[model samples]
Target: MIERWSRDQVLALAPDAASQKAAAGVSAPAKWLVTGVTGAVVWGECKGSGAKPYRACVDLSEPAYKCSCPSRKFPCKHALGLLLLWSADGAPPVEEPVDWVGEWLDQRRERAARQEAREKAKAEAEPTEKAEKVTDERRARQRAERVEAGLADLERWLRDQIAHGIADARRTGLRDWDELAKRLIDAQAPGVSSAVAGLSRVLRHEDWPARLLAEYGLIHLLAVGYRRSAELPADLAETIRSRVGFSTPKEAVLARPPVRDHWQVVATRDEERDRLVSRRVWLHGRATGRPALVLSFAPVGQVLDASLVLGTTLDADLAFYPGAAPLRALVAERHAPATPIQAPPHGIRVAEVPGLIADVLARDPWTESWPLILTDVVPARSGDAWHLTDHHPKEENAVPLLPSAAPPWNLAAVSGGHPVTVAAEWTPDGLRLLTTWDEYGRVVTL
Candidate 1:
């Protein structure tokens, strides 16, 4: 059955306002013919400039879109419009997709299988491929040199802002932010470019000055980390370089030794970029109590890797990216299929959270988010703020929860004025709940 997507979810998939605006015009029933959903797919036909109507189809399972239109845009407007129609509350319930839909689905599967086979073959050939590449190494070194020079410029600019004071920097306007971000991109430091763009969100807060200071601290820390990278351990050095916008070839990372465990998929967060849909899936070792993260990317109109699902356990081998505090990992092998788990694994206490934060920060000062599980905590509201308070009287400590927590009413209701276990992201920004478990041990993805 096709999982119904919400309008917000559909809008989030759009690359730009133009695509969304165009989709909005074609959302009504009158604009489509033979519109229906069957299995994991939604299909429809829309009148087009061409003599034949354009066929629009979407796979809801993987949630990929396919439109028989010549538009270079990945989903194009027709596919967006079709999804909007399907996501609409008044959408006509559909069953049994047309014959064309079935054929298209089959072809998609075949192409995906072929792509996977080719990727596997390439992975096998990488060691030899890498060894034969002196030219590639030289180019990579040149790129690194360029990035180092960019970082030096960035550090100087950041110091000038500090010398002038953050208030002056804020007063200077958004153009400063935009211009610096552009410079990073031009210098091939794309990771820091995005990070620079993200600072705008921090500046919008009521306490913008403090947030600005923190942001400055993070940037300065990254610059220093990059400069002194070689002095750091291999993994930590890799992490610092990677955070500074250096690309580590995926094949090389996958070739590293794998960490074998019955990995439990805790929760995931997905963000869309131009070429890839980046997803970060957190995992916990059932027996080892270790935490690792898997970063996967889905090409536009392709499914994210389906092997990891929340609240499931899998026997797998994870190859972690080199870092002092290794969290980002890749699945190198799967020994068994994932099985639904009845309860969340045992969690550390709220009191222990700070020490864990300190430990990871000691390793990578730029660490933004860290995974944490709390066994007994209650959601408490004090005025306008939400907090997670330790339910245990002896070990009680109240921690401020992020303001953006998914509607707190349900979480409060689930608490029933009592304690519950939760999986969350521990960050400098504050606790952002990801999943929770009732006293009965049933898991709920927030």
Candidate 2:
């Protein structure tokens, strides 16, 4: 018998508590008809609800899984259960894999070999930079035409909302919006489709009428912006194009001059969807005082790219993506890994709220959210309403907190009745805090 992992280690791979529980339930030897451990690979045949058994295999060396179960969940329950059985105190004996397992392993090896060959060919036959740019631009133009058609359709749909009363949003079915969004997806306009889906979510809210109108306005604004994009400034035009689902080439962005700064990582979040896991890291440039979001993605179980440690600063050069509000960016180069640093005495402070709004809307009206760092602000509660107020109560600075934001409990606790520099997002509704740096230079995510 061989045991490669502790029970806890095996269960840790489960995506959720439910999967962990289910894996434990099916870990008994009676549940598996055949079990074998061969080298770094574990293979098992578990009798499932169906007449035929389901095959499960895990490659311990690379920590990969392949299962015949129909469950879309990566490393499906069967894989987890097989690992649990293998990790049991009296584990399965090391034996040569059965015929079915051998076939699957062979297929995996062949696929990997083909992939290596393809990558090798690509590396050996790399296109010249000029050729690559020309190809990329041509593809971008074709995609832009499709996006334009989709935006036109979305604009017409927004106009239809005005024909009927705002209450008509309730009568509009979820599938109706989803269907149009799917069409936009087919038209390669994911940004507009995402906004359409957001509108659908808004319609379910208690204040659907007002939310619907606002979303309607946003779509109309984007449509109008798209039409007059060519007439706008170069950067603003790029911003509108990006908002309408046009992607800037990473190589092009990297080729541009990089902004060297000591960037402080403010907040970090990881979102897992289907087979992909995306990491969004927000970095605040200490020198330039600009906020940038660096995004990275990996397969479900793979390790992510270099991480951005929260509350730490890194001397790095970041390449900003072309946009009117250039928050999204890529780390082009780094002088050193991030290190802990005292909270610098600088965060962008909007002197005039209306002026900030006018500036952002002027650059890109359809921007749903923008980075906002408020200096010396405190979370406050007043007669069934919550908002952030400037340190001085007598001062004229008070902005309502968005309903969806993390309640101000943590912010209040961290503040302890004092003002703090807060990093938040400005939406159409109000401010939503992301991270806060207190007087003691301590950082907490709200």
Candidate 3:
């Protein structure tokens, strides 16, 4: 008989459980219990060292298999082999989940509920507090002082650049921006640094006069904002002043309780303009199932935190940056690393692609190179339409596909009625695909 599923595929679906083990040889068989979609649970145990022994309690209600193993690779090979065996037999074992498994399940539900309640309370309380006038005033004063200092430094630097000649700056290449940006950061003026970095871009582009004017205008604005801070409205004054050169300590910003969630580090990107550098880390919360964006900034030659790896999970407590629209963050207990998470599935209706492609008429439609995994592929042919069917049925939901004029890669047809399109590049870990959508109303990459 043909096997219903492969060993690797079944193992891939298992949740990570490395954090629960004790060091040294296992006196008894290690155990694991997994619940399947149909409310059935599988309990199993593992033994042996070089050649492992695995025993599982199979549940027929929903196909579930459990195994005991010490490998950090989730279900390991034993569980997958068991599931494969069960699938081929076409009959599930009749066994109930043990007390320990039931208890863990119960606790998970309770924790989820508590987290929801806390979030609700926080949301309700956010707008009720007084405007914090004293703190605002102090912050305003500090911002003003920093901006003044930064503008003075920037003015001096600009004069030096002019004296040395614009050609000298051009000869220095991209490194010049990095040096200036770092100086601005050191002078407590991230905003000015950002503005200065813009000049670098303008310098490279055609029609340099307007770009130069705009860059000078921005610098002039920073100078004016610093000079007129006392005369402006409190909020605008604060914004302008801060943008010029002020910085708040990270500790101060992270003082409040941050948003807590099991966050999945989805993607990371880095960019440098002038001397300033920025690292963007995108997170998706598993509990709330919401996406959060976090940013880290560094001056030239400085290194940022390397804790946030792609696909890993982190149970983080994050604080939002203080602003009108602040990003959520991790505050304390940042070390409680979670298991690696898989990207959600992205699929399309059987008939969506043909029309989408024909309408856009691009040889390649994906903009960003996100990996596209199609679970369900079905072939279809209409009077004037032919398309492939695909679906992403993960818990976090599939990323939407985008319509693009041309994508950089090709789409491969999978066994199911689906066509899988992946980015041209491949990493040792796996395929890294951009999750976006196309004009034909599909998520291609983001």
Task: Name the best candidate (by lDDT).
Answer: 1
lDDT value, residue 234 of candidate 2? 90
lDDT of 2 at 326: 76
TM-score of each: 0.67, 0.65, 0.37
Whose TM-score is greatest here? 1
Off by over 4 Å in 3: 1-146, 149-190, 216-242, 270-279, 285-304, 334-337, 342-407, 410-446
Q: What is the lDDT of residue 332 in candidate 3?
A: 59
Ranking of predictions according to lDDT: 1, 2, 3
Cα lDDT, model 3, residue 440: 35
Per-residue lDDT for 1-446 in model 3, tens only? 22355534554455644322221122122332232222444444445454644454444344443445555554455555345444444234445555655664577569779999999988886655434666778877886566567677777766676566565445573587788778777767777777666567656566665656556655766566567768866645555544664655678767865778877665576779669888767666667645456777899799977778765688788776543223435445675756755544233343343353343323211111222223343333333333333444332222222222132233322223343432111121223333322223232332
Q: Give the whole-model CA lDDT for all candidates, comma-separated.
A: 0.83, 0.81, 0.51
lDDT of 2 by residue, 1-446 (tens): 23479988998899989888888887888999888888888988899999999999998887899888898887788899989888874345566788887898899899999999999888776766668899979997988788888888887777776875666466764767888889999889888788887777776578877777888787788778888988888998888778778788899999988999999888776789779999888788887877888899999999997667888999999999987767889989999978986864376444566687788787777866777778877888877678888787567668889876657898998889887888877787787778887667888778
> Where is the poorest 10-residue window by lDDT in model 1?
89-98
Residue 271 in candidate 1, Cα distance off native in Å: 2.9
- Write the number of the candidate with greater TM-score, choosing between 1 and 3: 1
What lDDT does candidate 1 reach at residue 286? 84
Q: Stretches of candidate 2 above 4 Å error?
A: 1-142, 164-166, 204-206, 272-275, 348-354
